[model samples]
Target: MSTYQYWQVKFEHPDEDEEELKAVIQGLFNYYEAEYGVRRLTSQVRDYYRLIGKQAPNHKRVQRLMHEMGLKCTKYNRRVRKYDSSKGPNGKKGKNKLNRRFMSDRKYQKMVCDITELKAGNGKKVYLEIIKDLATKQVLTWAIGQHTVFCK
Candidate 1:
């Protein structure tokens, strides 16, 4: 037989076992809501085979299958944009007296203050205001509350 004919016969037929394994992987991927990456998926697949009394496929094989099937975990892949304070009009810009020199010989010589927003366990937004000393790398003061704006 010609080399072309032999190649066609060898490569044309898909493995039945591989098809079933791909189906299993797809089912697991959906069951976890696409949060399982290759490592976790491989572990789950191994457990599944153990439950069924069959030998589990190699992790590399599972990875290759996942790549071919275009499966990916979405949890860590999400991009969250941070809040930018310099974008809108508000107050006069503070002079850069520090001139980017963050280091200081004394604790209170170079201090910085910032406000951060955090989410509570009940899904409510909490704002935290903190003052820190750059020399000692310690927090001087901190306050937490629900409102970002304060009125006198």
Candidate 2:
């Protein structure tokens, strides 16, 4: 069956005023009063009902109403930590061979190498290794592999 029909069957008789609740939800999201998602918005709506001495609506109903109105919280859901300090210092750490000099008078005299991973649409990651000439600003050579471990 359709999702709308399922929800309708589940909530045959809703408790709260759906129109008013939609307005409250939209106001909460549009005004940026607080970081709100489904769970937080549900509690805030319940608090509003409590303050008005009326019965609060169920969270599922609120969620359904919010979905219908296309009101959503745009807050970030995850935190990304860039650096990891757990690994021990390896002996392979090398010094700055270029000595902060990026320019080169001759072609291929100075080059920079970098490796990065690209995610494909088939859920597989492809690693690429690129060598670029610093003086000419051109890519010299490149290699792509499914599982290329450039750093030990």
Regions of candidate 2 where Cα sits further than 4 Å from its true position: 1-16, 77-81, 85-152
lDDT of 2 by residue, 6-52 (tens): 78976896545666788887886666644688898888889888999
Determine which window of 10 residues in candidate 1 has minimal summed lDDT: 83-92
Candidate 2 backbone collisions, by pair: none
- Please give the CA lDDT of all the candidate structures: 0.84, 0.74
Instruction: Give the range of the ten consecutive residues with the poorest summed lDDT in model 2.
Output: 80-89
Report the lDDT of model 2 for residue 44: 82
**Candidate 1 whole-model C-alpha lDDT, 0 to 1:** 0.84
TM-score of each predicted structure versus truth = 0.53, 0.42
Top candidate, metric lDDT: 1
